[model samples]
Target: MAIEHADVLRAAHLARLGIDDADATRYVGDLSRILEMVDALQGVDTEGVAPLAHPLDATQPLRADEAIEPDRREAFQACAPSVSQGYYLVPRVVE
Candidate 1:
């Protein structure tokens, strides 16, 4: 999986990126190394290995679901220009 200079230039053009010749040369080597690393990773054996959500065995503590504040819906709705059936009314913008 070797990345060429022409490939880098084409990718840059497609992405609308402004890259010089020196930067393109550097990217060709960097991209080639990244692909080589990916190729190496693909060669690993993991036939019966199970996937894990997290590396460490830990559980997050959660608080009990309970309301701690008093309801003030009527008080807040009093400040609105229009409200109907426990909902704020808004001017229609579309037909």
Candidate 2:
């Protein structure tokens, strides 16, 4: 899990990051320590631990789905920069 300068440089190239020689050495050591910590965590027993999506047990009430008539279209269209036939007109992109 000890990351070398070569490994750091290779990782930088893969991630499209431009890392200089001085920073490469420092970054390699940091990355090595992180990898070591992860490797150490492999020794821990996490059996019988239930995976949770949310930290707290909470649920939102589902509302009934039904289509309903909305307010005035003319009023809504009035806010648009440009509107025609209840639709906003956007600038043309392709010729």
> What is the per-residue lDDT of model 1 for residues 1-95, given as tens digits with 9 covering 90 to 100?
99999999999999999999999999999999999989996787878988778888987789899888798999999999999999899998697
Model 2 RMSD in Å is: 8.3
Worst 10 residues of 1 by lDDT: 41-50
Q: Score each candidate by Cα lDDT.
A: 0.93, 0.87
The estimated TM-scores of all candidates read: 0.44, 0.46
- lDDT, candidate 2, residue 89? 92
lDDT of 2 by residue, 36-93 (tens): 9899977978799777778879977797897686878898888989998777899986
Question: Which 10 residues in a row give candidate 2 its minimum summed lDDT?
Answer: 63-72
